[model samples]
Target: MSLEAYIWCAALKLDVCNGTPFRVLLCLADRADSLGYGAYPHVSTMAEQLGCSDRTVQRAIRDLTAAGLIREGDQRYVQHLDSRYRPTVYDVLTTALVTLESRGDNRVTPNRSRGDKKRHPGVTSAVALRTVQEPTYQDSSRELTLVTAQEVEEDQ
Candidate 1:
């Protein structure tokens, strides 16, 4: 279970009068990974966990999909003895969070536009830059010598 996904799901402000869709979303988020993927529980499993019928769980899933909260993922086939059922996976879309943040009510407005005014003036200077000095050693005496860029260019 991914705590991050669950927290994000809990933070979502759904506009539903009934709580079934929100509960189902929380269940999916509980099974999702850190990236909000890999929630593939069976419909019956979710129904049992939520104390609701399979049809109710299915409807909740449909509602979430319609609301752009969760999306259906790839189906996995079972290869058990005489069993050939494909289970549907679900992925909690983080895009929903971005959409929520971009909404008119939730959007953050800047205090002022960039074209209004400048708080600080730009800095400009007309100073001449100097070349770095390099040190050289000769023999074991370890004498320190400083060489400037002009001297090195002249030698070259």
Candidate 2:
């Protein structure tokens, strides 16, 4: 587990994530390898670590999976003389962190317009102002360019 990865996970927006799911995500991030592969831990163990019920942990796993932040990986089944069990491996999608970092300046803000029927009532939206400037790179030597969501949509 990289300290930088854990820090990145901790800095995610809480408005879009419930407490349990966010804690579960942090736990997985703590065990992730350089490639974002996390070792499978028993549900009971995870529950203990997160200080929650096993059912809560299960729900968190479901939420993370549904949100596309984590994906099920390989499974290992252990067969004993009288019992069998399979442990689920997970791959945390680190690309989500990159996307989030790139959109750090863009956050959900309340839309006070009365005629904005395209948006739900009392709901907030993240709308980045369009710009025609060239993409900015954090590292000039690496040639890594940050593209906004609107830019990707425009390209498509």
Candidate 3:
């Protein structure tokens, strides 16, 4: 998986807060080249990796396409004696394309639209939380206190 692509997708708020779409996007992004285009895999493969149904993968693809995060490219077709199957090709929208289309300003800057501000105003970065201690009963009451690395550092 491309950590940079995942981070870019998350930071840019390109997806609706759904894990499936993000996961599908990540799969495509992982295979994408520098131009943000990649060979499309079968829906069954994506569903297997994401642990979702084929319909769910299709829905996520539709959503991403509608959101302009990805564009359908040339399709590959295999012709058999009695039948032919065509697989879709997906092209992830580059940062430049995303900025140009979504931002409404042809500038290659971060999108800070009102919707983004409303959804993630206070989120500056993602920090992983490690449990220092498990919850326990004290004085016949149960209380859970979660501490993060930032908190530990601050305490020190």
Model 2's alpha-carbon lDDT is 0.68
Report, for all candidates in order, the number of backbone clashes.
0, 0, 0
Q: TM-score of each candidate?
A: 0.54, 0.52, 0.50
* Candidate 2 wrongly placed segments (more than 4 Å): 76-85, 96-156
> What is model 2's C-alpha RMSD?
18.8
Kindly indicate the candidate among 2 and 3 with the higher TM-score. 2
lDDT accuracy of residue 118 in candidate 2? 56
Candidate 1 — what's its lDDT? 0.71
Better of 1 and 3 by TM-score: 1
Which is the leading candidate under lDDT? Answer: 1
Model 1: CA > 4 A from native: 16-18, 76-85, 95-156
Per-residue CA lDDT of model 1 for 1-156, tens digit only, reads 988888888887755414999998888889877656668777888899999999999999998999888887533322222344445778787654445546743422223234434343232222222244445554358576999999999999
lDDT by residue (14-77, candidate 3, tens digit) is 3353578888888887765544654366788989998989999999999888877889853432
Cα-based lDDT for every prediction: 0.71, 0.68, 0.66
